[model samples]
Target: MTADIAADILVIGAGIAGASLAAELAPHARVVLIEAEDMPGYHSTGRSAAFWHETLGGPLVQPLTRASYPVLEAGGFLKPRASLEVAEINGLPLLDKLASEFAGTGVGLARLDHDGIRQWVPRARPILVGGMLESTGADIDVAGLHGSVLAAFRRAGGMLETGRRIDRVERIDGVWHVQAGDWHTSAPIIVNAAGAWADGLAAMAGAKPLGIQPMRRTIAQVRVTTDDVPDHLPLVIDIAGSYYFRPEGPNRLWLCPHDETPVEAGDAAPEEIDVAIAIDRFETVTDWKVAAVERKWAGLRSFAPDRLPVYGFDPVVDGFFWFAGQGGIGIQTAPAAAMLGAALLLGQPMPDAVAAIDPAPYAPDRFVALAQR
Candidate 1:
């Protein structure tokens, strides 16, 4: 109950990826998860929009959704929440392209005329909308899903050390000696899952830096007319992804601009300009005006240069593994991401289902390959 002191596999972050990997690896190995904050998921994972749309991720990451669906379905982490993306006059071409890509992923969508937009979100103005409605997207049980992984990890003999903000790491006798405050932990296998802080950790481990940048994304909540907006309304968005708003309660809606501004890793805060942009866009698309802001916050969504998640062990380091650069798909793809980690750590054959998709596109070495040019 005090501290793990050490583990065979040491995970450096306590967000979705780290937590899920810890849960998956705990049953087979001695696993210890370390969090800089007093609680897990204090950053991006805690501030997610909690959507589970398989068609939204990159081509390389689509298979992760396919692989993770079984666990999500079995774990009851998803519930159908009707959703649509509206393309305005300026967004028609992009909307068409997105719809084509979505269709390729086996996601059912309808090319909605202005009238169709009003049918879904009643407040939506028909005159300026032309978009596609992705009929199969769902809302996620974020807290439940994240909690389940933590619960499973603990139940499987994994150790969790919270507020153990790591200060230093050094290779002594080819073993990593990690220091958090005065306490020390040594592990042969160290997973770089510190989310926004991943690059810093990699630097400490003497690994080459990957151009991982943490971007601040903000969200705000506003009151909606109860009778006009149903509690089960689909998540409505701009076809260009400039803004999105979804039902939070019978009379409340959550909204955010798809803003991505680079920032240092820490507790992200919502900006007034970002909030104004979302409200302005919401008013432009729908007749509803955001007169009151109930709440507002922000989170860091880190991304690699290619915008794909970096997985697999570092080529130069013997025991260091990369599991960062998840961007915004961390929760939806956690199951497969953790399984991928497990396979690499155990030095076992990749699961046939996952291997069929080929993980090389997302490997850490891909960055190395790009730099050679």
Candidate 2:
């Protein structure tokens, strides 16, 4: 078929990362966003737990999450939903340490005694001795966010191609020639935002591999035989990372064992053992009986060796950008991350939203030094 397509900036994924960045840059550049899947966000973006909490992704990611809050708030994609971190007697000290560490970070976490913890999460078993509440946490509308971003990109004259899986990439006379299926695309700049397949995409572009590992996370929706399940239930997580759950709806709960099994990039599915583990853990956390496993699914969260998102152009490959390794926090940090990525790609100053964040920690050059050692 050999259809020739050209763009000033060719983004190699249509997930949240690619869509957000394309939306940010489409107004200024000729952008083309391509997806291997039949539709955008068929992986992690669609399978996300769909919560936006300031402290969910750790201290390094908090800044990006905070920067993105305004956009999400303005877009009406955020709905108020608090998060509770419950701890057993042995885990109480860890909760205190976490509260102390985040003291002045603007992610206020209030220490909750046993009574307060129960008040927040009434269904929690008596094993919980203490807890902390992130009052600013909220549920994010993932689909809405992704759709809005892609719609804006298209409105700004960006081209979107689905079912085009890039198999070959080569730089020819200052232009990147990318071949996907029967279609061909050429651009001066190529953005690698292929999520779990990021390293593979970079390798295809002749860029250094960043050792991005895709880890599988499982989640299941179970109907609980309990009268306490409420639509307003806060997201309850164990301080020790054992399990987490929140009300999917009245009499229903969404739960995960907080598993991070290392795996390759592809369409992820929930393992039966993992599902059983999640249910088993949930039983220990709450007295609610699981009536049935309504549904279960799994998704991949890719991380760099340092477990931080990588952004900026490849230090060794000209016009090739690194915008992967966002892990589980990509959706919450999309607005700020995309802004920063587009700014760097365009050789512009950092946007005010993420100006305070230092880009050095996420630069691809960090791996270059590591690889040399």
Candidate 3:
């Protein structure tokens, strides 16, 4: 709104990543957030069954998750729910590797023997040899967190454009022109935060695609035969990544077969076969019967080739910024990621929250470098 310092930035994708960064940069710039969906966060953000665990996104993303805890916790968007990864006798070595993988990363991982894990999962099948517990893990309130960021963007005088899929994007006369339909906007910079559709969005801008692939993950909310399903059932995952389940409520649980099927970018629906697979995997672990499947849904988790988030300006595109490929941990790591992103994009020093993290590993140029080699 300043004539002396004219600025305009268009962020494409009003999900957690774009919303949070747009909010962060709004006070310093004129920010417009564009969403293809009618409502913001309607796609991947609303569908996430996410949790805050240092171990979830693997070692490379742990720092962001750890640093983001203060912000998420201060906002009261997390609940205490531990995550336990159990292994059968043959899978104990995998469990040990999990323990050693994060040996000194400051993430707390307590090795659990059969009896130790039994205390957390009393009805676990007896084939288990041991497990590891991430006591610091907690359930992330995805909706609350996404809404909060969107609210922050609005409060900071940022604009939100919805229901507009990008029909055309071109950089002309040193300005980028983007249009969803009859409406369009031009700015010096454009940020691609389009979640599952990121690679497609990049192509629209004449930017090289980073191989951001969308993979479908399925979930089923099932009613159990057991009369009293404890509210404290921790999120239990298989060491081999075969399946996972946790209580959605008393007598109701969300079961997943840990299936990550490759798919094209779009709205994802849970397949009936996947639901059956989840139930079959669930039965293999416990005596609790799934009395009924109350609900089922699927969401896309997009990832770069290396599975790390892409968070820098394109090495080739003049004004296109890459902020996609966050996978399933985007919500949990939003605060720190936004901090790092806004700082990098604005040419400012990173805030104390993310200063310890080096930004080179996540740069979009890494892919180009790989291609050159």
Candidate 4:
């Protein structure tokens, strides 16, 4: 084979990160997006409980989330849905620390008493002492957003190769030669946006693995046999990160035990124990009775040792770039993250949306720098 296909850059993984970055880079460069699954976002992006909230991604990540909101909202990928982190009387201290931590971050966190909690998440048990309300949160249309970005990539003449998992990656002279299910391609540069398989891809590209660990998270959708799962309910999360539940429909809610069980990278599936645990946690916070489990799922969220996204070229490998370790906030932070990635990769000035963000913190070289110290 002549390795007939060629592009300026080859992006591995067609999830939100790859699709978004490919879309951003395509107009400026010929890009090839390769996916292991038959469809883009068959993993994390599609399995996301899909919510965009300023406070969800931590302080370092908040900037990306803040910058992405405007783009998602303007694109109509966001729908109004607030978030609440509630605590029992014993856990009130956690909420206190949370309020003080986000004091001037521009994330509007309102202190809510029991009555206030009930006002938002109606029919709540009195055991809940207080909560913090981030009223600006919204539901993200993950599929719509991913599709739009992929469509934009196609419109920019980017080639998308699905059902082809990269099996071989080797750098010859100044080019990267990749083989995925018999489809051979070459590019001057290769971007590792492989999500759960990011570390494995890095190793294959002759770049140092950045300790990207894939952890499993489970979600279960259940129909409530109460006065209806209130459509007005906010995205309810426990202050201590034990559980979270959000209204999926008028009579159903999606619940999670907030589990982060570490596991190998592969096709993740919901454990029966996790589904039972989710329902158990749901009952403690509300009076709603779960009539049945309509559905359940699990997805892998990969993260770096420091738990921030890695975006930049490899320090040791000349032609390898990393755009992984986004954790659960990848979809929520896609727009800004992609803009930042494109600017860094293309050696162009940062766009106005993320110009103020200091990208050094999320760079791959941070690990190399850490070793020196």
Error of 2 at 363 (Å): 1.0
- Ordered from best to worst TM-score, the candidate numbers read 4, 2, 3, 1
What does candidate 4 score on TM?
0.98
Q: For candidate 1, report its TM-score.
A: 0.95
lDDT (0-100) at residue 145 of candidate 2? Answer: 98
TM-score of each: 0.95, 0.97, 0.97, 0.98
Candidate 3 lDDT, 1-373, residue by residue in tens: 1122223888999999999999999998998898999988877888889888889878889899999999999999999998999898889999888878888998888888888877887777777778889888889998899999999999999989899888998888767888777777878989999999999999999998999999999999999887666767789999898899998987889999898888998889999999999999888878788889999999988999999999999998998999999998899999999999999999999999999999888999998888889
Highest TM-score against the true fold, candidate: 4
lDDT of 4 by residue, 1-373 (tens): 3586989999999999999999999999999999999988988999999899788758899999999988999999999999999999889998888877777889999999999999998878998889999999999999999999999999999999999977889888899999976689999999999999999999988888999999999999998886556677899999888899999877889999998889999999999999999998889878888999999999999989999999999999997989999998999999999999999999999999999999999999999989999
- Where is model 3 poorest over a 10-residue stretch in terms of lDDT? 1-10
lDDT of each: 0.85, 0.91, 0.89, 0.92
- Model 1 spans with C-alpha error above 4 angstroms: 1-4, 352-355
* Candidate 4, residue 166: how far the Cα is off, in Å: 1.6
Best model number under lDDT: 4
Q: Give me the displacement of residue 206 in model 1, in angstroms.
A: 0.6
Superposition error at 38 for model 4 (Å) = 0.8
* Preferred candidate (lDDT higher): 1 or 2: 2
Model 2, 129-155: lDDT tens per residue? 899998899999999999999999999
Question: Cα lDDT for residue 236, model 2?
Answer: 92
179 in model 2: Cα distance from truth in Å? 0.3
